[model samples]
Target: MSSDPFEIFLVATPGLEAPLAAEAAGLGFEPEIQPGGLTVHGHWPDIWRANLMLRGATRVLVRIGAFRAMHLAQLDKRARKFPWDQFLRPDVAVRVEATSRKSRVYHAGAITQRFERAISEELGAPIAADAPITIKIRIEDDLCTISLDTTGESLHKRGHKQAVAKAPMRETMAAMFLREMGFDGSQPVLDPMCGSGTFVIEAAEMAAGLVAGRARGFAFEQLAGFDVAALTPLRGAEPVTRPATQFFGSDRDAGAVRMSGENAMRAGVADWVRFETRSVADLQRPEGPAGIVIINPPYGARVGNKGPLYGLHAAMGQVLRDRFAGWRVGIVTSEGGLAKATGLPFQPAGPIVAHGGLKVRLWQTGPLGG
Candidate 1:
């Protein structure tokens, strides 16, 4: 990474950029919501911290260099003289990807080829398609900016949750939604229709102050001058002092309950979270203070029949209104009519979020007056 203030872009899942930026800003980083992600200025340690501690970012990129390249010839000339030795080692392999928009250098394949050859020849680094380190170059309006993807795989993998349900929610999206729903981990979180217990597991981890990336490795570990000694502090486990408050989840499927249990165990928060196989109609709040209740129920696009989903939503709403008084509620679904079928007093629907090629929105309710 660069010395003083390198540009770090936190990739957000399109519609959730604002919440990611808010989470970053709350962590004391100066965050600006850009078109696709949140941009922040930070040094090398900040890069490590963002990858290890940030729950909302899908990937982190460090801008290495930028210039104006009118054509391939100019791009090649600048690429040859660029200081490749500063950031990459001779043995490290890299994959290059390029995008061109409204610029004279419009051929993306040729652009990637230039970077690949340059790194291979000048830096003596091999170019492989499956390399952990990737060089991403963007050419827009004759301006070319080069960045390195410091995150290898997506951060949502999180090295836990080996078991997953169909169309499971990404941990990155779940964390941002939790933040949007004012979840600070101080109170209990219940996901009645929890598919794989994403919300409940995430809440327990947050309350335990667990490092998001501790269980996994990052692309930054493959970078030059990546001292394991220097990265030790960032990887050190903070004392997990979870309060008496517990997180809860229940799904009608016994398989889902078992999967949730296995995932929480791998995440090292099984002691703080509880999961059971129970239908929403039989949903009852456990013994504890009233906390947030969030659910990502199927919207007929994927799982259940449209006709029967209305009754399911109505049953969920009835159970919440009857049992979960003083608890905030948020539901993520694609159908507005289904939300209305709940008969719960909901606030305005939130932004439409893109999920698996479909658009979904979050409808929420304040603490129940019932």
Candidate 2:
């Protein structure tokens, strides 16, 4: 924990690096995307803020140390020597994950075993693979680096949604979708194909001035000398009142509608949003002036069928065009053919962002006008 802004890494869905870096910069962090993730130069406070505010990031990592190790022994020795007292706690459980390339520690399992033993024996820390605290290791050629996952569960979990549909929305992707649409809290936001209500929940949270990290406990809290006290003000800050009808979500599936409503209640944003069950074709335009309409419909892979999705896209596009005049529209899909099937003119706006190994892009129309 040197005084200098520690090197932090933000792992995301590949093509999302640019947007994630832009998000980091917006949060006052200096971020640069490297190969696997974005590297940010900042202090612990900056790291905390990134974990709290970065909606597009999968994980926030603080680079504890990096070194060149020619062999397994060197890796173990360096691993043990890494001032574990600063990050590891004797009472807490931790997990070790490793990846390798041309390095001598070529076996990920072997690397995890050795590193796990080093921490347990040298630092007197316990090891638990399923634990909240995780130590991530990456070995590219001869370079080995170690980082700590400050955000235990993925930021997408948001501590809500005990139930979801077949293809629910990921919080990171949902946030990115909203960002692409330039969604600010000022106007009404809608998600007609709301699924489990992820987009509406995220929109409401943003509108209500809620910090994404406030509702959940982070893995970093269990680490040694974790300044939970320093975070008191953040946790105690007055929760934003649910804005009146600023956010709306609907799904055709009645079960999904019930689950979304429950999830919103758990997230304490029920008042900020309205949830209903309706087919995408029947989606009505918002009563207020033009606003943003975002949708993450089933991409065929998750729903086990794509035959009806084409019709869904067409109907959604028609609704956006005929009913929601003067509003912006955004849709996320991994299939370009289906996107084009919408029949509404749209331009692709993304690099191939990786999601579960499938590359997805956002399709957007210019201004929603006749």
Candidate 3:
């Protein structure tokens, strides 16, 4: 609120800090990678831009201020004195969440209550459990770092993907995985087991130069000093030219195909993306230059029995190898053995990423030979 550059944290999916940082850097931000996220120093517009443009960040947090509080009494005293009106609005409700590590104030609930009460009484702001604005308090080694969640829902919600399939991949993870697979949005991308068309739709959006948050509203819009007109330029008025290279997705389930098409339409990428109900064995290379084929297939952990999944993976690998020449492949699965069953010449697997209570990795390959 002071118009000074502050710390902006781009929360990354675990094990994917590098790709997220790369994305941040590509977006003209000087990103410093941390264990689970990256930090960039910037002003309010920078925070707004990050919330709008960053596809890999799960959420963006702006560090408002910090103070050293040894105990609850000191925390309460400082909380009452802290200037909450600068960032938070009295008309908007807020939620306070706190975490304590190796600190005297070890009770997180008490810390949250103290801060909530302080804001409610001092700033005349209402506190609610389901508030759109979130104040994050991290008390580590007795140093309390106060940050605000500028992203209301996780960025993955993207707001347009209303129809979802079983064990669907998050859009944030999908974007980073596409980055990991070296997708630059200029070439064709196909997902044989495209659940809800996440990869295909994301690729199409990237290719069409669509802002990731264009269709969604952010929590930062509710902040005290937010200038709505200032964000208009970031939300460009330039019309999107359809990409020449098409994005494709296929699923054996007709319902999934319909869902994919509906999601793509909602995302405004239907003109550039195609979805169909087809099994992996029936997959044929579309008439075009080869590109990337990526799939988040069942890993037996969630979808179904593991025994038949091996055959499914093998069949998928066979179809790609036999038909989709010159295309690179990336298969995401929880079990290494399932990835191995693909029989594609995969390079060493990428980092183990946390997805839906299971650990998964991307098994990638160079362009397949004839």
Q: Which predicted model would earn the best lDDT?
A: 3
Candidate 3 lDDT, tens digit per residue, 1-370?
3767999999999988999999999989999989889999998888999999999999999899999999899999999999999989999999999999999999999999999999999999999999999999999999999999999999999989888898999999999999999998888999989989999999999888889999889999999989999998887534366688999999999999999999999888888888989888889898989999999998888966799988888888888999989999998888999989989999999998989889899999999998
Query: If both were scored by lDDT, which would come out higher, candidate 1 or candidate 2?
Result: 1
Q: Which residue pairs show backbone clashes in model 2?
A: none
Assess candidate 2 and give its lDDT: 0.80
Alpha-carbon shift of residue 164 in model 2 (angstroms): 1.5
lDDT, candidates in the order shown: 0.89, 0.80, 0.92
Please provide, for model 2 over 1-370, each residue's C-alpha lDDT reduced to its tens digit, 9 standing for 90 to 100.
Answer: 5676678889887777776777778877777789767987887767777777677888888888889988888888888888888888987888999999987779898889988998899888889868888998999988998989988888877766688776666888887777777777777888887878899998888778777777777887787777876776665234566565568889888888898899889877888788898887788887877777887767887667899888877777877788888888777888887788777678756677777667788887776766
TM-score of each: 0.97, 0.92, 0.98
Candidate 3 ranges beyond 4 A from true positions: 237-240
Ranking by lDDT: 3, 1, 2
Worst lDDT run of 10 residues, candidate 1, spans: 235-244
How well does candidate 3 score on lDDT at residue 229? 93
Q: Is candidate 2 or candidate 3 better by lDDT?
A: 3
Candidate with better lDDT, 1 vs 3: 3
Tens-digit lDDT track for model 1 on 222-305? 988888888887874653676578999999999999999999999889898899999988888888788899999988998768
